[model samples]
Target: MENEEETLLKSQDSVEKRLGRTTLLDSGEDFEMLEEVDDGVDDDLPPLEDAGGGRKESHQANKTVKEITDPSQCPPQEEWLDVLGNGQLRKKVVEAGSSPDSKPQRGQNVTINLKTTLTDGTTVEEESNVSFTLGDGDVIQALDLTVQLMEMGEKALIEAKAKYAYGALGSSSTPVVPPNADLILEVHLLSAVDAPDLELLPPSERISLASRKREQGNVHYQRGDYAFAVNSYGIALQITEASSKVDISPQEEEELLDVKLKCLNNMAAAQLKLDHYEAALRSCVSVLAYQPDNIKALFRQGKVLALQGEYADAIRSLKRALKLDPSNKTIHAELSKLVKKHSEQKGAEQAMYKKMLGNPPDINTVQKPQAKSSWSISWKWLFGATAVAIGGVALSVVIAARN
Candidate 1:
């Protein structure tokens, strides 16, 4: 028992030596540093009496204080940025003035500004207000898709290549867009209009409405509303197809066919407005299929094909149209222009080939040198022989005179 007591005292002394003199002996078993409590006091004010409880409260308070002071520890904001699957990032910049309290809904008329930069360092900035009807071909597919995902008054930056934006043909330029050209658009949602109800109309009334819509599209085309005209024409085409199931009079059928052809023609014109040469070509081809000898269709197709750089096909189509309508000044002018251009191009190619082959001697340069060489060679030999004979004669005369 005395040895055990001595061992315990020695162990306590060693612990105290390591921990310092401020070590506390709890129930004569557990040892702790008194400095721990003292350190807590130094952090804030004087330490309280309830040592264990005070440490717990202090730790909790420190946690709460950190959460309040540091924003990273706070809860996230309600509205967040969403990235689209097509690698587009969207964010809401402002709420709509029309519907300030409510979030933006679909089928809104939005205003967007687009700026496109060409490789030549030229930039085109365009601002347009587009009305979007969900699943309707009112706006561009990308813009429509983007606006559907956006809330009212939301602003988004969209990145679309030419394929998605304008397909191969770019807006208002020739030679349709090059492959994979990226376009950036900044969109702002202004107001949303609710969708119109089509179910309310009777069957006959629906047919009439569709016909009216097609006529309206024609009117829009006449009035130079090409974008809206294209949209209206698309709706007309859809309505006419739907109405084809029911029996119609011969006149009505012919009217529908004519309207369909007119819509295709208008669509071609609209595509021309947008500088979509390939799309315009397709539209023109559709029109010409129904009316094979359509002069307008043939002429426009040739023009569009030419714009697309299909020069040989363009020439063929344009020449065929000119044969049918010999008096078309436009066709004649275009033919003349193409001929001159092709000739100049051929000449330039020949010149380039010649340049690659290096400069050859001119006929003047060759003839002048040959003539001088021939004359010099003949006179040089004769002059040398005559001089030698003259010297021999002089020697003979001297010898005779001396004798």
Candidate 2:
């Protein structure tokens, strides 16, 4: 209501000025006496647009476009910040984030909604709302630097030089920014996950955090994100050890150890899915290192080792696992498989050995001579005649000498 009145007064003043009526026409000579008229129109009601054939265009014109004429209007600039080390880059915080306590770390993974615009106000891309790990060079350096300074649920506007973004080459074919162009990024951090710092936290806190992380890992595992699940479990294990290593009540100790074992087992499961046998083996070993008779660890170790073709070690681990949990059908089945595989491998090796270094050839079977034919008799006669001729020549020579 107030805005309409204000607009009306402004319009009236402008019309009066155009007519050269500095003061209201004191006398009624210039204009006839006009009486106040009420048009039954609500003062707050919007003016009707042109009721013409181009109704849509008329309606569109009714909307008052708010143009940002000032850089300060972009966002509330509480303070200006020089960022990205060399101090060429900067950010103006429009609205402070809600979760000031949840700021992202250097190596944490973050999901953000990004809006890139050129100085001339051309939209470069729609790749905002994308997920990526920070500090991995998966995104522009300016973005990484910008996000590191932002808290969860925070939004910021980044002003960056080309070097921090696309540099001289100017990024991809339809580059968001041309060569040597500065960019403005309106970014919102959707979510972030930071690796836990287990070593410093209190023991009770460690156990609690460990449990939470383990559950998070389980959720990731159920979602089939094995790599992330493994990461979560790794964090859980770190907390577990940190809790147990410090001074703790016996009950707390047991709780921490239990969480550790479970996390290790879950880690191994995820690693198995990811085909990270060595990592899976390490997880199992970690569990076994604490509790030597942990059935799950032994079984997982056996499974990993079996897949690696270490039948002997796999059998040993599985047998131990089975002995600890004799009623476990899975363990028994796995051990049987390893044993069977071991026997088959041994038999195959023996067969190979026998084939490669088998018995020497038998005398009778040793490649016998070819059978003789009519040609052999002819060859023998020729040889005998030559020998007889030579013998006769020798005998005649001996007689001549004697004579």
Candidate 3:
């Protein structure tokens, strides 16, 4: 079977040929190579399912659509124009909106009716009257990026390359998208309005929005899309932190702080998955700043520190977490592994230095031969005996004289 990356390349080629184009997107970077991009994420961290607990049903689980795998049956791509001029995203207008002059801008609240289908004519998701805030990470990056360019009352068919769509890990939504699969979307923009400032929204609404983003992050994380997960978590943090700038009841304040900290903790985990150690460390520190006793934050801080080779600091952070949650076996195991690894690292350094310096002379061993030589020992005994005889003779003469 062709791998996901190969499938992506083949699919893009097919689409490009159908559109009478040589290349649809930048072919300079392979999708697999894109996955290797430096992010501070650590590969050694536990897989999403293991670290995040059991998977939750995708929020869009109810939006399942029937699959159609006939390769020859697809929408015509002749009129498709590259939206971003980068070939990664393309669109063909099916119906023009009423207000062409008024397009949705970033941070605007937009409502749309959308039907999503795979290239094989499989309608994966169809929903009417969906609403989200633009650039808030409430929707896929492709939709958010493309929709802002859409005119009010416009209906268009969007063809997104995998990078801007569900990406490498794909989507776990109903009709499950395979990894690296491109996305086909039929979207109708119903309405677009200025989004309320996060500070202007009711405390409850802000919390709800932030919580939803956090859940969205969880979905992305479970699908092994750490980059998207990190983005979603970051949005949640922004929402919660923005809400903090406005005065609110103590209860609301506490709730917002809790949500913010949760986002920070989850963001750190996603960052770790991306191998972004410094960013992950910052996220962990942010969470700890709000709640010093946060076990998750401390534990993540330890992991990040350890990954960055700050073993001593890592040990301190883990120990702090262990002090709070002494019964946590995960923390205990992580701490033990860190301690053992640190010891091995120290031992390796010592051995390296010793090898470089060579062995030093031992003072006791150097003097031992001279001190214990047979001739030296014999001479000492002879000298002592002669001295004793001389003293004895003198004493005898003295005694004889006295007698």
Best by lDDT, which number? 3
Stronger candidate by lDDT (1 vs 3): 3
Write one digit per residue (lDDT tens) for candidate 2, span 118-218: 55555665356677556543456678667777767777777777666665545434333466666767788888887445555667888877777777666
Q: Pick the candidate with the highest TM-score.
A: 3
Mind sharing the TM-score for model 1?
Answer: 0.40
Clashing pairs in 2: none
Angstrom error of the Cα, residue 192, model 1: value is: 15
lDDT (CA) per prediction: 0.56, 0.66, 0.74
**Which rank order by TM-score, best down to worst?**
3, 2, 1
lDDT of 3: 0.74
Go through the candidates in order and give the clash count of each.
Answer: 1, 0, 12
Model 3 stretches with alpha carbons more than 4 Å out: 1-78, 85-88, 161-163, 167-170, 175-183, 243-247, 361-403
Off by over 4 Å in 2: 1-104, 107-200, 243-247, 359-403
Question: How big is the positional error of residue 172 in model 3, measured in Å on the Cα after superposition?
Answer: 3.7
Model 1 lDDT per residue over 1-403, tens place? 9999999889767543432233221212111111111111111111212222110123433453354337886433222233232343323233322332333344433444433333232333434564445434444445655555444555544545454454443433321234345554556665666644444434454456566665555544443445556677788677655534445667766666776776687677666765778888998999888998877778778778877767778888889878989998877788677666667877998999989998789988899889999999989999999999999999999999999
- Residue 40 local lDDT, model 1: 13
Better of 2 and 3 by TM-score: 3
What does candidate 3's lDDT look like per residue over 142-231, in tens digits? 788677766677777787888777777765545466678777788998888887778688888898988888887777666566776787
| Consecutive 10-residue window with the lowest summed lDDT within model 3 | 24-33
Model 2: how far residue 351 lies from native, Å: 1.3
lDDT of 2: 0.66
